[model samples]
Target: MKSLLVVSIVFVLIIIQGTTIGGTRFPTSDENSNEEYTYVEYEEEESSEESTLPPIPTTTSRVILSTELETEGPTIANEFECPTNCKCNKKITLVDCSHQNLMQIPKNLPQSTVYLNLSHNSLKTLNVNDLINCGELRQLYLNNNEIGKIVNTEDFAKLPNLHHIDLSTNAFKPLQGKEFSKARGLLTLILTDNKDIVTSNVPIIQTEKLKTLYLANCSINQLPENIFQNLSSLVALNLDNNPLNLTQGVSAFKPLTELRRLFIPTVPRHIALNLCKNLQVIDIINLSLENHDISCFLLFNNATYEESTIRTDLFKTPTDPPSNSSIVVSTTAPTLSTHIQKGTEVLKQYANAAANQAKTTYEKMSMMYMILSGLVVVLLVAILSVFCIIGSRQLGREISYRKQNYRKYSAGNVTVENPNYERYLIECEKRQFTNE
Candidate 1:
């Protein structure tokens, strides 16, 4: 009997387990029947020069084109007038003068050449005389070369259409502001791995239209306040792996309002968090704030702030008025530490904005207080003056009434309490009759 009962319980348990395991799933499940949901993100305008600078590169001092970053393409015929020991494309447009190991720039380059790859050579200083013929050049690659510096600003000016330049992995001296001043339409510049250019301050990036700039591994420890003031249109910037003091000031990057991507990894988690808090553009895909993704939070917060600012401009027009309550989502809620840091940063910004608002509030309050105080004083003085006038008039009337009563008393009284008028007249009339 016991064996039979145990068998019965075991059979029941197995049936229950099987039902729980496979009952929820449909036997004829069509996986494609599930509806898919997608978010239609607002499409931003495409970059103006996607050809000049590729999407934020991860490698440094390495040519994007590989030795041209020239790995020996098809060798053009001499009929195309290609320079000796150099290779040119079929159309004589993309010239590859790399790996020849010549001391100076090659002569007799094609006039119509646009892309010039002079990298991986032993050329020392780039003289203006060599690049005079390449006027139509657009992209110049001189990375991994011993060339220290270009001759002067006029050399870049000669190439009016020059857009992209890579001078990475070279020995360059401290660059003054005038290095690329004349390159007006310049778009992308790569100066990575050049240690000597970071002596006092960063080379003044004089190119106003510059969109992308790479200054990684240059040991740049200090950043001036207005270093990036003129780079308003810059879209992408890389300053990673450098010994920079990011706590110096956030104003250095303030002018880069149009900036979309940044690569700055400071040591210690809190420092990086603080810097990230101050900086507005931080790509979470490239950086990890304690392994927390703040992209959603930043995007939501930025969108909210921008929408609020526009609304304020359209509805409430004031010449630089401070916003009172604009924090929509509190930046984000990534993790405990990030949330705390973000909260602290929000507090700091609120403190600053509140201070401005408090100043105006305080000023208005003080003015109201003074006006009320002055009104009270005037009212008190008027009340006192009215009482004084009323008291003087009452005193004068009392004095005149007392004098009039005294004159009447003098006429009527012989002693202190006198007599009646009609009785005296009757007595005078009786005395006159007795004398007659």
Candidate 2:
């Protein structure tokens, strides 16, 4: 009877240990601690949920945990559905599957996932069939992967609410707009630092609603006739590390009437960016025309002090997009409040741009003054030299006139018709007649 009682006590302890914290703390499991997030655990996961370590999947069940969160009070980890192999926060609907060396998309992702990060992984192919589970996905990060190209454009149709895709540092180049043709609400696309974009076609991006684009160091050397035909509403453009020249009578930049901040590497002497109203010198001048020196955006922005009309769009970051009606997306999204601070930064950038512009104007004016002073000095010297020559000629002529007058006076004044001897004889005869 005593043995039976002890066995029951031990079984009860085991059960108790599985359900309670037991006065032990496990580390938090989020890699991106850059922002605040509510932590959660899988219903099936019990002990590992308290650990921040990346959980290894078991044969029976994958045990993912987002445990022991800070900054937010109390964890409702039991309320969320999560896999054992990744971190999940159901309150914000964030699933971070990054740095897991995932060969393929995980099948057990929470249905409510909104922000899915599969970056820094070994994903080779992105098949759209796997994305049917997260129909409400908004921000998809597939950067630093082996995805050569999107398999099917139609598959992206499943994620209608998707926007803010990052395909940087991937082999998914030579893009036609069809790759994201179905992502109608797409706002931002980052395709920077692609090695295989040497032959990227002109007008690579055809997305009209695109606001921010990062194409730095993409080997873009030239523009087509209608390269920027579609992006009328583009805001910020980073064309750094390119070799483009737009002097070929191509209005590649005219279409970007709504364009605002244009980041480039340098402004060559002949480079002109009249559309850019401000100028600030930075490393790695992004070229778009004529040896990649100057273009329209650089010229216009650096020279003018106009307040950015794009401020509303630049400062106003959208709030969490509503989840699609068909699916409950992840809720872990950036607080729109952060954009308020970013808006302030925009003001600061304008101030800095203004200061830079003023400094540039001062330098130019100083240079011009120096040039004009030199020209004036040169002109003054030439005028003085001519005056000196005239003065010398006048002095010589005056001296010659005085010398002739002195000679004529020394020989006694005589009329031109009267000879010197005749004047002397006439004077002598006049004296003799007077004496007689």
Best by TM-score: 1
Question: Candidate 1 lDDT, tens digit per residue, 1-436?
Answer: 6445544554454344333222221111112212221111111222354433234432232333322222233345534467777766566766777777878888767787777778878888877668868887777778767878777567777887777787877888877767888887677788877876754455467777888787776767877876776787787777755666766655577677667656553333334444445456533312211112223233334422212110111222355334332323333333333333443454456568989999999999999999999999999999999999999999989866554443233434553322444455677799999999
Q: In order, what lDDT does every prediction score?
A: 0.58, 0.53
lDDT of 2 by residue, 72-145 (tens): 22224546455545665645367777778988988755567777777778998877667767876766777668
RMSD of each: 20.9, 25.6
Report residue 99 deviation for candidate 1 (angstroms). Answer: 1.2
**Once superposed on the true structure, which residue ranges of model 1 sit more than 4 Å away at CA?**
1-54, 57-80, 201-203, 267-285, 288-436
Residue ranges of candidate 2 with Cα displaced over 4 Å = 1-80, 90-92, 198-202, 246-250, 273-436
Q: For candidate 2, give the lDDT of residue 421.
A: 47
Output the lDDT of residue 61, model 1. Answer: 26
TM-score, cand. 2 vs. native: 0.46
Task: Give, for candidate 1, the lowest lDDT window spanning 10 residues.
Answer: 21-30
